[model samples]
Structure formats: structure tokens, C-alpha cells
Target: MDGDEQLLRGRVYGHDHDDPDPGPKAGRTYAELVGGPLDGLLLDIHGWRTEEVDDGVALTTELSRWPGGRALYDPRPGEPRAAGPGIACRFYYSGDTP
Candidate 1:
């Protein structure tokens, strides 16, 4: 797919504000969020620590609660072949928190 199409389908996350480019870049890697409300969303895990990715993170979403809430997701073992290559991890939705 083209850059524009990928950008539209994926959303960047993590603490890499220092990087000049925050958005997805050409050939950049990301993790796919599976299941839950955030399903099908791509999380940009570039520059993220290995432990952080392994432990999982709470992704803020506007899908739940009046003022919004967080969706907890954990990285599953191995890459999700179904998502195709470049998708380095598969974060499965555990639950939601307000």
C-alpha cells in the first residue's frame, strides 16, 4: 500500500516524542492491536523499549465511557502472519478500564 493509505489505517503511539518524525515512516515497523475496541488499529512501537512492549500498555480510546477510557492490550508471542510482514507484534486486547 501507499504511504497515504498506510497512514490512514495506522495510528502512532509510544513515548518517542524526541524523534523528529512522530508519524509512521516508510518501512517503519508497528504492532497490530487485535480484538477489543481498538481492534485493527496499528500501534507504532518504534523506539519503544523491549520490556515495555512485552509487558503491554494501556491505550487510550474514545470508544468507551462518557469521557473516554483505556483499553489494556498484551503482546502475544511471535508476529501475526495473518497481518502480513512488517507487523512485528500482535497486542491482544485484555479488557477495558475507565
Candidate 2:
């Protein structure tokens, strides 16, 4: 496929780079990213566990300082919605992962 096509299918953090208005996809649930560089990004949590969502997750992003690096994202201070609807929760970008 072409670059644009690849970007659509290879989205990270639920963001389609080519799409102007990227948000939570229909029929799919996601967690909205809050602070840091990855703010406003959505993370798909189709089959995540409570601990995984409560603890946090590391998301791969090209925006990291190092190549193929991942960014640490944690849920909001008091909003741990592992069973919420649509945008289940919000994960804030903490830092880059080694």
C-alpha cells in the first residue's frame, strides 16, 4: 500500500495521521491520552485486564527520542475506568521507555 494507506492501518494511539478528525472509533473502546507529548491520543483497550488498565501501559510512538522507542502512559489520578464506555479512560504520557 501507499504511505497514506499505511498510516491509516498502522495507526498508533488511535490516531490516523492522515485523518483530520481522529477520535474514538465506532464499536471499539479506547482510552484517551491526557498529558505530555501524546496528549489527546486514544489507546485501544479491546481485551485489557483491570490491572493492566489500572497500572498503566507502554505505547510505541515514533515521537520518542530513540528509534522504535515506547512512551510510558498512566491513567488519570482518580479516573480508573476499566469498565467505562466509549473513551474508557485517559492515560497521561509519563516518559519514554527504554
Candidate 3:
């Protein structure tokens, strides 16, 4: 949803925040989904493209690892591919990043 966007400090992913019908079980809110849990802090990244999968996978893998942080990649086979090489998907992290 990115509705309560206020300078995201930590990495967040999946689901929308603006939607009210969270779902049958009432999924977690945007902030809670991204900022909550705080269990180990999970980062999600998806890269589209049959060939660029390797290139993008390497990137998110590096991003998720932040000394005390972790990240994961789920290409989903066909999420959304970039136009060429300088677009498609972009990732960001926080706290003493590398």
C-alpha cells in the first residue's frame, strides 16, 4: 500500500497498506507487515525476466545480508521484468548498510 509512507527505515514487502479488506483472515497492515514481526527481519525481492534472474537474484541476496540482517528472493517465475538493464526492479535497505 505504501500509504503510510514516511521515510521507510527498514525493508518492507508484499501486500498493500491502503486496502481495508485485509482479507478473510485480516492480513497484517502495511506497516506491521513490513516493520512488524521484527522477529528476524525478512526482506522480499522479485525479479522478472528469464535471463536477468541470475543478475537480480545476486543483488537481492547481497541486500538482504546486512551484518545482522537477512534477505530472500522469490522470482515467482514472472513477477515483472525490467525494460533493459537499468530498470524493472529496484531494492533498498537501511541501518549501517553495505
* Candidate maximizing TM-score: 2
Clashing pairs in 1: none
lDDT of 1: 0.69
Quote each prediction's TM-score: 0.65, 0.68, 0.24
All candidates: CA RMSD (Å): 5.8, 7.9, 12.4
- Which candidate's lDDT is highest? 1
Worst 10 residues of 2 by lDDT: 3-12
Assess each prediction's global lDDT (C-alpha) against the native: 0.69, 0.67, 0.31
Evaluate model 1: give its TM-score: 0.65
After superposition, which runs of candidate 1 have C-alpha atoms over 4 Å from their true positions? 1-24, 65-67, 77-85
User: How would you encode candidate 3's per-residue C-alpha lDDT over 4-75 as one tens digit per residue?
Assistant: 233223234332335453221212211122221232222232233345543432222233446434443323
Write candidate 2's Cα lDDT for 4-92 as tens digits: 23333323474568877565555566776667657766678867887788888877777776657888888776765646446666788
Task: lDDT for model 3, please.
Answer: 0.31
The alpha-carbon lDDT assigned to residue 36 of candidate 1 equals: 84
lDDT of 2 at 14: 43
Looking at model 1, report the run of 10 residues with the lowest lDDT sum: 78-87
